[model samples]
Target chain A: MKLLTYFFQWLMSLLWVVALQAQAQPTQPYSYPPSEVVRIHSKILNEERKVYVHCPKVDSADGNKRFPVVYVLDGDNHFELLAQYIDYLSRPDVLAIPKIIVIGISNTKRTRDLTPTNSLLNYEGKPDSSSYQGSGGNEHFLQFMATELMPMIDKNYKTAPYKIFAGHSFGGLSSLNCLLTHPDLFDAYIAVSPSLWWDKEYLLKMTDEKLKHGSALNKMLFFSDGNEGGRNSFFHKSLVKLEATLAKKKLKRLDYRYKHYPTETHMTEPVVAYFDALRFIFKDWEKQR
Target chain B: MKLLTYFFQWLMSLLWVVALQAQAQPTQPYSYPPSEVVRIHSKILNEERKVYVHCPKVDSADGNKRFPVVYVLDGDNHFELLAQYIDYLSRPDVLAIPKIIVIGISNTKRTRDLTPTNSLLNYEGKPDSSSYQGSGGNEHFLQFMATELMPMIDKNYKTAPYKIFAGHSFGGLSSLNCLLTHPDLFDAYIAVSPSLWWDKEYLLKMTDEKLKHGSALNKMLFFSDGNEGGRNSFFHKSLVKLEATLAKKKLKRLDYRYKHYPTETHMTEPVVAYFDALRFIFKDWEKQR
Candidate 1:
């Protein structure tokens, strides 16, 4: 009887230790979430660019799945924002949008690569020669993306043909410029308060000339401006004109939306703009999926 | 004549090489943009938390100056979004708000900490026993934040007393719960589509009893709901009840606002909600500053 009692006490103590271990070790850090950074060499730009890539938590069931890619310019500025949105929106519970691969392209040269025309003009149309000296190399930048960057990204990652090009300010101009010059590069374009006034409203004029009259240009475009001035401001006027130009063309299969954020500033526009852009681009996608 | 020509050619070639080197270097990778990750050990949760912190490009002109901190919940979700906004909005050109530090708190046990009550009831008022078995620990969670999390954050990072607590969904519920229970913890509270239906409107009952009628709370609360179940859904009804409760009280010094987004869904609300929440919270801050 004494031996049996001692053995029972030992068994109870062993169970307590096991219970404590289970309580303390809730979950392993590896099981939490995973995010990675990928680097690609761009021969057009002649530089090795680092991209912050955040993918959804892949389950074992869906091992061999491809995802739509959102290539956001100014990776340093908005990579994390896009990553967060994609993560939350594509959660198993949310199911607002499908899981996506967010590739944030950090900027190397803002003025040189993102602007449409080479000009020394600043926001006020004044020659800020020092700041704007190396402007208007966006075409080369797009070439870099088309021939070198995208191919490298495609070769490395599990990417679907469907891609999104997004940017803000000068970056925004680059996004629109890419769409106009190389429309096949991406499925959708998001220009958040694009600098249309760059090089004497070069892209704004280009928009009017690019689209064929009443012809099909199957793409989704979302453009917006925050309160750069008021509703009557040049910033607002430019976006309105872009909208009006698209409306006049009435191009078949061209889906576009222009939003005016009276409350947000030019700087704060991307936060809301990117969100709306994603929603706009994927509006039909959700229904179809 | 041959000697002189050869010397001139050598000089020109040297000058050409120097110019090429100057242009190719790429402006020292813009050293002013200092964004880095800081890992700190948290005693509260007993884990090392990796916080992605972004400070304003610290101007050498402003020596040893500190800025206000915005403690964003769901750090993994909205840290980058808020960081980008702060960086852009506080630019010399934009100047909408002062440069602020963003502290993104990544989650460990999100459901355990963020939810207010320990109930098995899901959103549909159905018991999901396995999913919510360890629920209703938000009070203890808040205590952990007050005693352990905040101090650790304040100690490691350059923080000011002026703090803002921002969250969405379960995080949103936690934010409101913090406001109601520990009003002194954060100066402003932002709850974007908070789970007020948690534990059969546990927070709704607590809000009425905690906040005295016509009393000075001296706090800022921003709450909003998207098209959760249309306008007449239980989610919408709870928010309306919350608004009505506060209205009936007429609490002095409690600056609050409720926004409704009919176009946005529960998943997509945070994008627009956060933007509007920041605008509302800081509406008077600009004038005051």
Candidate 2:
């Protein structure tokens, strides 16, 4: 009986030690909601494109629910950020925005596809032939997006009709270009620090020509610029001119806002601009929904 | 030979179909860097505290490097956001800030631990028994953080001496409480729309009493208030009074800034306030580093 009691005591001590150690060990690393990488062969661009898709977790209450989709450019740079924002803002506590699908279209040939015109002229309006070579393929890229990528996303995901296109820098230029050329493609567009100095301000001119006076756009557009050079720089000047042009057009139902982050740098602007743009785009979403 | 050719053609056709189907399927879901749930048995709190710890991916060059830590309250709400921010800001392309560890302290009893005073009075200076039942354990909570949590983190992770404490609302109340009482705990403090109205404007009163005339704090603090009840509300008034008190102190080496987000609400404030606070705290870090 004495031996048995000692044995039980030892066993109890061992279990206690094990429990204490187990409590100290952390649980498995927590993971963010997974985003998938989708591969599609584009007939228009004649390239195999890889895109990142982030979908929301659906509850039983969200039965047969279709989500709005935000297609962002420069997938490698900004996909995760947008995905994070969409998830957070759409949480049950924060119904600031609805649960939306984020489709980040990764680049194949960034320079060739993002620029709207073929020109050697740089931001300084000087020739830089090597950099500007094969630059005017944006139309083909847009066709690829319109005919190939969008269809693929809509076919695969539980998608709503409301679509948004977002981008930055060259990607920002591409976003604005799409807004001007294929305004019907997306319901909203975000252009963060668009390289408005591209090809002798080609898109700025296009924006003026395409947006007819007193016309109905029925879309939301949020564009902004950072202090790229200074107040006197071409980058700032172009954004001001674009804003002025939009004002001049007096396009009815073209819900748009141009924000200038004077305190931010070109590189650092996107972190804040993207959040602000989302808020501006979906300001009335909660009440409307 | 003809039979063999027919077999080869059939194989090729089969292969093509298989490849197309394979391409249509999405690649594995892209994952954000994971954060672990660390359970620490706090003798003071008499319960297990779960903290979300997000560590940066260390490369060969960073083999022996240590990182500063930011301890944020309301882990469940804001942990992911801070993790996302740290990852983006510290990227090679961004590099606005350095790689840092984020420790988000999830709540067990939020009200009991966050409030500084034992009072039944609510934000409106009226008695509310049910809501303020177990308030005024902040000092004990701070003690738990200082004695139990910080040591465990230091022991397990590669930690730098510099630390930051961030909180919002009631959590913000705790942060300011810590700053006033245990000033040595953190290098920086961020209070986003702090509940200065707690206990009939208790913290606002405490702030004035704590800072000695021309005292050297040698710390950084970023405090902001949103349009939480409008310009005439006590929320705005309390923040203004706090700022005025800090200014009157004229404490030496206390690098602080007060930002007012007239556009943001109490709940939506953290989204922008946190970003702005981070920028303010790390404004001189790049140059200094």
Which of the numbered candidates is closest to the native, going by highest lDDT? 2
The alpha-carbon interface RMSD of model 2 comes to 10.4
Error of 2 at B171 (Å): 1.0
Query: Taking the tens digit of each residue's C-alpha lDDT, what string does model 1 give over A1-289?
Result: 5655675688899999999997764332212234556666777788887776666678986689988999999987787678767877787766778889888788878789888888998877888989988888999988988888778678777888899999999988999999899999998999999988887788888989988889897989999999898988777888899999999998999899999889887777787888888888888877787
lDDT by residue (B85-194, candidate 1, tens digit) is: 67766777656677788877787778887887779998889999988878777887777778876786677656778888999889999999999888999999999999
Per-candidate local distance difference test: 0.82, 0.90
Deviation in angstroms for A159 in model 2?
A: 0.9
- Per-candidate TM equals 0.76, 0.91
CAPRI quality of model 2: acceptable
Each candidate's chain B TM-score?
A: 0.85, 0.90
Counting clashing residue pairs in each candidate, in order, gives: 3, 0
Candidate 2 off by > 4 Å: A1-27, A287-289, B1-25
For candidate 2, give the lDDT of residue A148.
89
Any residue pairs clashing in model 1, and if so which? B117-B136, B118-B135, B118-B136
